[model samples]
Target: MSEPKHVVIIGSGLGGASAAAALRERGYSGDVLVLGSESHRPYELPPLSKGVLLGDAEEPDWVREADFYADKNIDLRLGTTAVRIELGGRLVHDGSGGEYRYDRLLLATGSQPRSLPVPGTDLPGVRTLRTLDDSLALRSAFSAAERIVIVGAGWIGTEVAAAARKHGAEVTVVDQIQAPLEPVLGAEVAGVFRDLHTEHGVGWRLGAGVAEFAGGPDGVRSVKLTDGTELPADLVLVAVGAAPRVELAHAAGLDLSDDGGVCVDATLRTASPDVYAVGDIAAQFHPRYGKRLRVEHWANAKYQGEHVAGNLLGEHEPYLSSPYFFSDQYDLGCEYRGLADPDNDELVVRGDLKSREFTAFWVRDGKVTAAMNVNSWDDGDALQSLVDNRTEVTPTQLREADLAGLG
Candidate 1:
């Protein structure tokens, strides 16, 4: 097929911005336009919950310099929301009544934070962190907050607890799950995180649901749990989870997956031939895993964005990489690679778990499915290689200090 004459990308997050950059770098001089819902340029999300919430960074990590798009002759419209997509005519409509026709279209519409389904959520101090503005607002609130209550023990919830503690706020995290990150990291590994936060003076009320956000006109005053227990708090953060932004695609009659994202083939193309989806909103058929999986991590956004650019130019290569994500809470930092289920995989540990320095591997039927290194950066490559290659390893081999023979 002939190269697309014009490419329009909706949602100017990291994935969309990276696609535009890759297109330009690959010598595609086509007309490229990127529509961003936020006023600011595309920025990374990791810093929002870490450095930005901690008040250590004033601004987000930009995916590209503000001048990069202009220099490449790319039309990047900020603070623009795409309202509709007409697949029949290959046109996209924005909120301002502006319409653009394109030879190829990309839906990089990322996800939004899920709000706590409880009363008084709209109160002044009850907030959710998903954007740069949200992080700034939380950072400002944390400065004077005496007691902060975070609903959920996910990455954002735990990270916010660390930040709140650093700001000298008495923090308590409440979650429906029995342990933080239990579903993703399994119980053995999740216990380490729970202990780490506990050691840092972060309180937890696990396996409990939020019945209500008790507050008056002033702001949130306390969080009432399902067990009729109430915890007083001046600030509250609801980080339950996020839902993919797929309204435009749904209205356009696109196919959606059970995972709540736009369904795509192995090449990241939607049902419509010239349309594509990437990042957190894409439920793509992974070639390596042989299943349709949607990843909501930074690495997926960065790599899939660049990969889709090549496919848009007729490269038609399949994305076969494993899912990966990292988190930093206080002095404990860890990186996880691959996809594994706690219910099906057996957990094995290497190095010292007590000292907070170790590599944990999830093996399924003698093959390594996933691995994580906590404060042990040197073994990252070895662990990643094992997961990527589906290397068959015994518990004894995985526990061995030498990783030279794993690959």
Candidate 2:
């Protein structure tokens, strides 16, 4: 089969921009069109919620400027939204009713923030942090809000709380779980977060779900919890989670998994040969874990973008970059490497939680399974390689030996 001559990537986020760069780097003399939904050029989103809100981060470039696309011979379309897909004809229809035929199509639409599913969610003071505009408006509201209620204890919720606290907004994190971040980080270890927030003067409402948002003319007056307690608040942030953008794929009859990602094999190819999905839209098979993984981290999008670009240009390489994710908030920064099951045994947690520097390794049945480190990148890199390589390490040795390097 001959290499595809035209590659059209939908969504100009980290994933789409990196894919275009990878395609040209691989010596693929093809037409690359990058379409972005936002009016701004492909810009980074991490800072919008965290660094930019904290006043420590400047507004940086998203990926490349508009002129950079011209320098790279890439076609850049900003403020354009892809509405639907026609698999048989291999065309992407835009919101404005424009159509473009492509030899291979990449769906990098990414994800949207999940909202609190309860009454008064439509209230004026209620907000969800996802896009640049969302963060900007939320930042403006923070200056006036006396008490801010943050629903969910995930990273985004915690990060926004940290920023709001920095802005002198009294913030409270309401979580249904026993502890903050227990769903992902495990309850035993996530205690650090509970203590971290409580000690920092951020209020906590545990074992509770939202009943409704009670509005009193100006804005939200208070948040009603499931425990029959009403917390006083002027602003609320719903950071429950994110849902992948899969409506276009679903409408086109592409197979979608329960997690809302388009199911694809290692090569990032769907059942329809001409259509390839990547970034947040693609749920790819992982041979390492022997399970299908749908990752939503920043790195996943960038790596999968490159892989789909190569696969489109006849390279046929698999998308396997070792799933990793990280979070920075308050006084803590964490980086995760490799995949780990929460049910796995033989977890080695080192360092002191009281002083906050620590690293943990997940070993399963005598092999390194997954690892997480807080401000401990060196140890994380070593353990991650072991997990990725399936290195064998006994519990006794992992506990006793210093993990500076396995070199």
- List, residue by residue over 239-269, the lDDT tens digit for candidate 1: 9989999999999999999978999999999
Q: What Cα-based lDDT does every candidate model obtain?
A: 0.92, 0.82
Candidate 2 TM-score, true structure as reference: 0.96
Query: Which regions of candidate 2 fall more than 4 Å away from where they truly are?
Result: 402-407
Q: In model 1, where do residues sit more than 4 Å from their true spots? A: none
lDDT of 1 at 321: 86
TM-score of each prediction: 0.99, 0.96
Question: What clash pairs does model 1 have?
Answer: none
User: lDDT by residue for model 2 over 1-407, one digit each (tens)?
Assistant: 47887889888888888889888888877899988988777776778878777777666347776687888899899898999888888888999999988988887888998876688988889989878778888888999999999998887888898899889989899988888887666766788888888888899998999999998667898999999999998999999999998888899999998788999988888888877878777889877777788988778887787677768876667776787878787879888777766655566877766767787777788887777888766675576677778777776666667654441
- What 10-residue stretch in candidate 2 is worst by lDDT? 398-407
Alpha carbon lDDT of residue 118, candidate 1? 78
Number of colliding residue pairs in each model: 0, 1
